[model samples]
Target: MSKRIDPDNRRRYFIVGSVILEIVTPVFRQRLEKDYKSKGVGCLQDFINSKPVIHILFHLRHTNIKCCVDSTNCRNRRKLPLNYSQWDLLYTENPGPPKHHCHCLYTTNNVKLDDLDVTLASLILLNCCNLTPNEEISIKELREFKNNYLSHNIKGAITEKEYQTLWNDLMTYVLQLDPSKQDDFIRIQNRPLDDSLCNKYFVCLLDIHKKLEEISDKLESSTAEILTAINGQSNMELLTKLEEILQYVRCQSPKEKTDNHGIKQQTPIQPYKLGQPIVTLHHQINLTSVVNTSWKVTDISMMDDGRLVMCLPVQSRLLICNTDGSQVESIHVQGYPWYAAAVNNSTVAVTLWGIKCIEMYDINNKLKLKFISLPGIMRLDSGITAINNKIVVGGENRLHIIDYQTGKVIQTITTKCNPGRLHGSGDRILYCDNINSNKMYWYSYTNARHHNLTLPSPPWDMTILQNGSLYVVCKDGSVQHVSSDGKQYKPVKTLQTTPGCDGIHYNLTQRKLMTIQNKNRLVTVYNEI
Candidate 1:
């Protein structure tokens, strides 16, 4: 019998709206929408339950992507969810009629991290090239850990007893990063040591792309030889060696660098032309707090029904206020909440520290619906967003996609570095990695990482507009505008605050940019381009 390649062993999948899609035939450009029972838009649960095949040939080597949603399985038609949400307090419900007027409000300034693992828990201190003593020691420890654990295993050091020991140590490191663990192993370590090291090592490996390019040259030559051996049928043993080498070479291909901003950039579908300002400041508001305690505005969003939601991490409240910043209603939750997003007009998902779970709450009733516990030490370092009826959250190393209804983790996307504040639009996910000097990584739904943008300063949070423009608030008090093409980005506006900007949002219905200042405790509004 001929050796069979198991069909079920396929590795990658994509959840588009209510559809579960996998590239069934990579070469033929065919995709299979995994048949599921649900009729409405597919959620993360559908993706988790479906068996799919992963086709590596789908990986893109050029800037142009040649892929499409196979419509054969798309039985239901639904609106492609808005990239940015809308809010209009005057109209009482979200997605209300468009108004030309701009509004701003003061948000809390007492931002505090309840745990070390939450997103933006600590801003990376930069400007100096050398590492801190503690940071250096942590990096050294990471090298030792990798060698003692992974390196030895790869080198054939796998006795059953040794394997168990290695597994235990790996789990120990994972647990320490998990929010549920509060014992001595976590307390004395300050921020998770493993996380710190991982981020540092990633930065140190910035030259990895250069190495990959060098290896790609060798791989090309070896592949040609392998093809010849296959034809001759004489170099079977040599062919096997070449295949092994090719596998390792294919791992991390060189990502193209297109801009001076950071590591790599992709050629935009349509590059932006440099020109006059497309957006300008419209209004500013200085808010006075109703509560006596200090608070920090960590994240912001517009609900479908037009309410403005801001996450007060220190206050453990999801502050809902009108556009003009009057009369605020708050929902209290246990532990400190980092960020929040609207699942719908009536429901919101909040990422919590200490508890280490993302909780879904009924915003109208202010009732806790249920919580989904995180697996391993996955830290939701970035606040959460609802994309295509699923929760999009990220930490240092990965992005977690969860089913909004079930609180089940449907899929996880690995990131290049420690991803902090992130925003999602359709299949494109944009995130900032403070550990890598505030590098912005853009990931498409089909592939792992698409492109990267380096910012002048560490970014606190980002918001995407309806037209695909990206607005990022940096620690340097400047808000940058990246054109839809990703080729042009400039400081569109500046804040007078010292500590600089933190939370940001782009209201699609109103066509405005909303940003919160960490130092001044003020909110600023700008007319969109």
Candidate 2:
């Protein structure tokens, strides 16, 4: 009389176990061996056998960790004292007379790649090991996967879409660590999860749960001692230390409880309010070297992977660039490309000028997916955004919502003036008509109402921040900040450009803003201060 495990949960459990055991551990082992060998240690096993105590002490000192456990308990438990420093969860003392015992974490007088687990491997990589930039990013992402996803997933379940997304992200990280193991990972992902395999994975899941609980207990027991250690520091330094401590504590905390309907209720994120603008120039990329000097970037959008998609009307192409404006690639479109919006991680929807068609392209493959033709709308320009699996297209004096999959117009809204540029989030759509008015309009999908906010000049392009507030680039070489509800506004940043700023995009993940200026030949990036 036990509840049956959900199929999705079984798959998730299998993925988690196989990824940690089959991929992560081996990669960590390889890196550790390489790092030690480069330091003249011969091999990892030789290093561990020769200087176990030194190895443990070196890492503790490297990470600036100190043991807070009492001396009496430390002696009884065979733990290091406060002077030698200790990370209780990471290292342990060898079985011997307490005074003569050596502390070790990697392995006890032996090194076996199969003996390493996700937690131990991750700790070693993050705290004690040397890593390249790519390897560092990959390991940190894997750590986040453990802290955020696996620890909180009490049910061991994931939806189909969630599984695909997680698979792609984790695979990317795995390849970054060691590209040769791609086939091994693929086999693990495709392996069938029979009942025996499920049971084994369930045992691994229980062990992870136990480890998480131990982490939480240690954090709770050491908070007071940690705070005391940071006493007398400057207020800013103290606050920063406290915040870091709290962040780790929160990550180790249990998952939130579900409501009556068995759905987890998440606290809504508060929208950022406009204040004295704290923006600084981060980078300026001149596109004149890559493209014709006269060709202009009429619009810009940020993809999920942090790349920028820009519209080149005169060139009739879509220009793609890395987050730093490197690795530039161009896709030729059939007509003049006036605007572009990212539909998903790999897809972008482009609006062609003087054509009543919206072209969806797979940027990764650099090929057109489909064209959605609007019957009544004669032309399309810089007014397009993807929201809730639908594409909102702006035409002469109206907005059309088209189903991206079916290529059918599902809803239409008549506007008082022409809609030029559009952006949407959740149930709201914001648009501006640079030709007809200097006013921006916000439309509610649920209530079917319109709200307007007047600006100093016509708005050319806009992007929303994580908190729902917007950064709007205007026709007067100025950028404005507006509240979520469009009730308040302020001028935040301005560009020194003639013919005004035509394109703008905010990368919420990076907290950076990209704007096109100098007739779209110069691209300026700003960091949020």
Candidate 3:
């Protein structure tokens, strides 16, 4: 018989959904299990990881049914595209036993047990390296990692040497996670360090040693010609050549000075870091565009031909502008326009806030057809974007990931609360979580991982860099640049701005920053800090 849905499935789903929804919240996550147990589901987390979800309903008529469908869909499948390292962990399968798998976070069935450890370890390792105590370790699970390993059999998969290296790295970060270290991290961010912090903590010994080991044995042999020249030629010419080679080595390895402002940073900012390079502006030039309208610009979209389309919320109008922020055309949108996104060179998609659906426009800014108009979200304050032939709309307590080609929801990722701003880049989605108490939720759609190990401050607008680093402007008037690596980070080098910062975008190819500020209604522009 096909595995029938458990009779207790409804109750179990209700318990799991209710418990997870409640427990993971700001206040509940802070509570101990002993406290949650008092709420009648002491072992709810344990059940969450063990629950077998065979069937999931996409839509349910009742609230109780909603629990079952939503809970089952929130899992990572092996078929999903994971990062290279995560893929490597999967390849190195440890098929010891299913019992060894995580019993509280995820259900183990298809993925090997060893992969689970590796996956969890890798995830923790990423966070351990990138996020400070202020960001990750205030929680109980991370702090408990030092003592508990489910049933306490915490052994390394790699050899002793590799294990020691990983442990040392983890320990160094664990110490940094101490509340004592957060002030230091924040302090160093405000000023430059006297010595090279990168030389010590920043250097992942494993990575460096691996790189060095790969070349070390071959080095002596590759220099055979030089060695022979040195040994046989006792002439002054040989000495001169030797001296030239030494000088070349010295030139190749120049000293690194973070104290200086005119160089590049090799280790880009980590995601959890709150500070980023910024500059201030006082000049307000009307972005000269030809499509003159009394309506204010509510949304901005960039076309493949390097033009911008501005959505006028009041008049249901779109003003197309050139690369220099000059106007190209003014097209009228049917009904009221809320947000829009660049789909391709020939098409752009718009979300009708006043109306109940999405509309697509031709490159000339002419309406092609109405796409998707889910009534549930149209009535709410919502935002939409067309990414990778897919339309992502946020409202109704969920993000509807709809495919434009088929007009279907490919996937629906529950964010658990209201998302203020929704933006997407290269299959990556970022939403400012009104629920994270303001933190931005960045999902690398391919890998199913948060771009950074942690969110910076609760964010307002976010722009993705060429290298996948996130340049975000938080409500606090601070701009933060977080690297994709999700590791150790220091704040900000200001390209040239002061407080009252508001809007920000990374001009990846041009290497510039296009920023708009509310504190000073000026369009401040600068080479990225």
Candidate 4:
């Protein structure tokens, strides 16, 4: 008998909008929208809930995309109530309008571990690079924790035992830190330990401790008593309570030194371009392995103390090992997290799908604070980046701007379409069409103009050089250079990504571009051309 080969992989992506609306087959709409209890434009949860199937809404420069994939199992849709949502990141352009305006991960699809044993809390101490001395020791002793769990090799799945042990060790570790140090360690262990976390990490860490304790006490009490306590606490506002702590934290720059202006000095630009290198994108699903590890060297990050942090993406969890990639120290994160970005050396942010929110954590993986619900959008493989104190977050058709100081949404600028690789520097945002005609455009958030320039073939991602030059990752696994304003985007003499291309980041100080080319498993570090 012959074995069945997978030949039905669909990779074609199309764009539809107010202008080039696709020929929506009436039969298709009739069959799919029979249960359409509500309808309109813009992402509507109410309308989507009424239907079943994987529905993705894409809003483009001058169009709108409503692509619905039939539920793998129509029955599962009814039984599980698993609904997908999209927002306004790729909707239509916004006029600066009674005018051009615009609009709107994880989990259920990830491995479902039965116990917390799959948690690898031991990675904290495994950081051989000395990124986190305290964490390295914790990971080493993780096996000693009575509740430690073990993770398996299956893709997208974690071993439940490892998860439990990891959390137990985390709980124990937080209990042992001195108030100040404990606070920092707690948040880091709980979230991704990236160096670019916004300034809110430390402040949020303290808030989480307070809130979690309150919730724990409430849970241990009777329902009525808990409700009463909750009501009383409601009298006090969360934002107001955090004001004083927020004031003490400063916006730590990503640079190596501080300037007279009180900000960290950004690295100077070097003259060169992203050289030609064949990069690939790994998007294989149902990958079978006893323990598929992704520590194959392309990951890059610095510690809160300013040391290099070597990281690997294993399924939903990130294993932060030392520079040598030996002695697994501390593996932070509990579930299948989607993406992460460092606020600073000491803090990072993670998105938890089950909860539909993004949280900030300290180096020890302790929850510092939970902010902004994803507003519930669908579409996996999105992006988030923090520059200075402002943040550029990818939604469906909008680039959500977050102000960490006040912990609020400062502004949500409209975009052209579903953004692929998102990078922001100074005051500009550069993004690609993810999977369209393969185009890239720049948004001068400061001026609110689309720059009227475009790149060839949709781009994969982009980053800015020290001289403020733009570098774009193309669909073919290559990098190109563009004018700062995106007016002149010409292929960077030579650069390429093959097999499949994913994400990218640029380190100004080191003059390096870190990226995950083929599988997002191997991180590649490249010097200027």
Model number with the top TM-score: 2
Mind giving the per-residue lDDT tens digits that candidate 2 earns over 1-529?
Answer: 0135478666776676667655776687788777777878865456545443345443443333332322222222243222221233334454654433323323333444445556556656665567888888998898677656554544555567767778788888988888876765755565554333333344344333343344443444455554554445466543443444344334322233344433332222344557455457777888888887676888888764456788888888999876567767879999998878888766899888988888999775678999987765537554899876678888777888888889989788888667788888666678888774788887876567888888888887787765567778777778788887778888773443565666788764445678887565788877666
Q: Tell me the spans in candidate 4 whose CA falls farther than 4 Å from its real position.
A: 1-270, 273-314, 322-334, 352-356, 364-368, 376-381, 405-407, 489-500, 527-529
Rank candidates, TM-score, best first.
Answer: 2, 1, 4, 3
The best candidate by lDDT is 2
Against the reference, the lDDT scores of all candidates come to: 0.48, 0.66, 0.45, 0.41
How far does residue 193 in candidate 2 sit from its true spot (Å)? 36
Estimate candidate 2's RMSD in Å. Answer: 19.3
Candidate 3: count of backbone clashes, pairs at least 3 residues apart or interchain: 11
Model 3, residue 171: C-alpha shift (Å): 68
For each candidate in turn, the TM-score is: 0.47, 0.53, 0.43, 0.44
Measured with C-alpha atoms, the lDDT of residue 147 in candidate 3 is: 25
The global Cα lDDT (0 to 1) of model 2 is 0.66
lDDT of 3 by residue, 55-124 (tens): 1111111122322334554444434323434334323334544443321222323332222322233232
Ranking by lDDT: 2, 1, 3, 4
Candidate 4 Cα lDDT to native:
0.41
Tens-digit lDDT string for candidate 1 (204-301): 22222223344444544557653453443355553443454344333312224333322233222223333335456755656545544385777777
RMSD for all candidates, in order, please: 27.5, 19.3, 24.6, 24.0
Candidate 4, residues 271-381, lDDT tens digits: the string is 334342322222221212322544332234534322233333344454443222322344455554555566764466654434445656554444455465566232454
Separate clash counts for every candidate: 12, 0, 11, 111
